[model samples]
Target: MYRFLVPLACALSIAASATAAPRLVEPRLHIDKEHIGPARIALTFDACMGRVDMRILDVLLRERIPATIFVTARWLQHNRQAAATLLAHPDLFEIENHGAMHVPAVDYPTSIYGITAAGSPQAVAREVEGGAAAIVAAGAPQPRWFRGATARYTASSITEISRLGYKVAGYSINGDDGSLLGARAAEQRVAAARDGDVVIAHINQPSHAAGAGVAKGILALKKSGVHFVRLADTVAPHPTPVL
Candidate 1:
């Protein structure tokens, strides 16, 4: 009886640890030839789920700034209304896939991370294809780009995803708003922003403390004449083509 009880306890411990693991796992970003030559930067927003911020969308459209927004299935389900509003403004944003579930395991390697959302090429296709469908249903053009969950992915995953007809979107710089740093620190982070830098920030998490600072930094840079362009415009054009 005691031996059996010990085994059960061990199983419970493993389960608990697994549940506590993070959802994003390899954390790689890609910057190709065009970005290197032109000093062009791509500003990207991730809309995972929960808490929507229209202010970010408002600023982009009002300023005529174009960005790539990576959306998740959860976000599409929860913010269909807001999604419609964003799609209507094609001039300001291009919606792409963040992944179907935004699960951390989907982006990590097998041995390092115990979980993987799209462990196989087939699974990756579903997340990418399903996400595209969701955006189309919400009125946005199908996404030709795919940014893996948590920005973590393997070479094989990248190859498979690309083979399946999606270009993996990566970043050159990060705004670190997810850290929830205040506007001051946020300003400091973006102060280093330059041409050809792909900067990532979260627009879905409205309550993020750093959101205000991120906005300020962009505004300040714009005043200095930094032209903002969508990632698709600046990235290496995919063979399948996305207009």
Candidate 2:
């Protein structure tokens, strides 16, 4: 009886492992230089649940730089004025879906960087669809791109997202490390962006100094003659796999 139980337990362990979500390396996307031309970079800001970082938005407006702003349903719900501000400048800002609740797009029970994931393929779909619905309801066009919270995903989640007909938005440069960097650090990171780089920063943490730095960095990039483009203006295929 003991031997039989051991084997059964082993089989169950194997089965569980087989069905467990496989965490893949976080995807990094970039502008295809051949397709996007030279001296151009894509700036993408994540408006995860938080107040609008007007420092960054103000710079974009003043400089007329084009950006892709990925927003969650929660952010939009609490930031109607900011959303309207973004929509007010359709020529400069293209809002995309971040997620329904800023949850990582992982189709399993897990967490990325301490944030809980969406947990299942079905939940992932609801997240994607819910965020899209919220965006449309907020008066923005249907979001064609989806950038999951934490920018991490499992293989199954990526496949699910693709099956849903939205291109996943990834980034080549992390400008603020999720708004954790100091002003100088964020400024230097973003100011260093080059042609065909897709930079990710946060526009939801106004209290953080990183937003101010990001603002400065954008001005620096503009001063150096770097052209900014929205994600809609260029085709960014699935970024090169990190793993």
Candidate 3:
């Protein structure tokens, strides 16, 4: 199962209403935390598709920043050498499950942007477990966290995924807005991050402008004395129930 190219329709689904509430039937959910501490933050990257952003990888390697990377099976197939390289630095990177095919992690019949939800509880589990299987097959440690295709999920889907024994990793900051926010805006959004934020940006698609912004913002944060930590160092809080 592979997602050839991210469907453009996924844009609207990924950019769901910022003012909506999360419902069991259909929910738009993510986390919002001002600061986890005074000067500590966690940087999580997504290798969802496309080429690995060496620019982002270079900064993390040079600074030795800790990051939790959510990798989809499709990406693993596309970037094996890079994944192996990242795994070689176990101390700096924690590999996690994104999904088998980069499908939205929901059981609803609705289509997000243009990507359809997994559609059934069982399908969701397969999407998740398949991703983990890919990681382990590559000789990496089993993932402890799962971040869905577009970071969106139904309430039940979250519960189901949790029941499977992995916590869903949601970010406090949308650093790249699925990589639509230009490099500068993406950089500012991340650089202005408060303490304890779990910032997510794509490590795939190096050509995208967002990756560039994330690198600069990460570098700026490092210079400002902000300590970058892994998702496991602290905790990836579950999303709150939408109002």
Candidate 4:
């Protein structure tokens, strides 16, 4: 019995050590230029919490540009009017899950960008599923994608999210550093986006200048004839992970 226990403990230690550490990755979508034809960009916004940034929405509405929005259950519950407005324009917006409580999808006791993580596989499931359920309850079609808060995840969490039958939405360009950037900085970053780029910005901070800049950058992209597409419409071949 003692010999068996020793081997079992050693195996457990080995397995634990093999688990990969959490990585901060910027996930990039592989756009097929031949199939897509011309420059195609996907603009994704995180409605994590707080009021909707009308500055950004208004531009999308006025210009008829389509965008994918990842919303948290908390955000949906708090911004009913904004949710309704988004739902009204099914042609321009596709809503996806951003987790239930706006927690990072890390299967350990850790934090990402100052936000607490899900901390366990079970908790991660709860966060993802809860957000999906909220979208359905709000009268939108079931979400096919999930973008965890902070856009950061543990390898195990990413696997778990995929196992749950949702594609993890990752961004190639960060238009706003969590809505912390000023207007000019955000505009510059967003306007510089290239073809096949997946741009991520925030739509939950109405007062933040980043939202205004995002609007301007999107207009600039439109002026340059850069076509916009939604994640649901294009095939995002395996995301390239950035360390």
Best model number under lDDT: 2
Q: Candidate 4 lDDT (Cα, whole model)?
A: 0.89
Error of 2 at 54 (Å): 0.8
Any runs in candidate 4 off by more than 4 Å, and if so which? 1-26
Per TM-score, the best of the predicted structures is 2
> lDDT score of model 2?
0.91
Residues 120-195, model 2: lDDT tens digits: 9999999999999999999999999999999988777888999999888888899999999999999999999998
lDDT of each: 0.70, 0.91, 0.83, 0.89
Q: Which ten residues in a row have the lowest lDDT in candidate 4?
A: 28-37
Model 4 lDDT tens row, 150-226: 87777778889999999888888899999999999999999999888899999999999899999999999999999
Off by over 4 Å in 1: 1-39, 105-116, 177-179, 235-243
lDDT of 1 at 122: 70
Candidate 1: tens digits of C-alpha lDDT, residues 94-162: 889887777532433343334456665577678777777877777777788888666665555667778
Query: Candidate 3: where is the Cα deviation over 4 Å?
Result: 1-38, 241-243
In candidate 4, position 71 carries an lDDT of 97
For 138-185, candidate 3 gives per-residue lDDT tens digits of: 889989988888788888898999999988887777899888889999
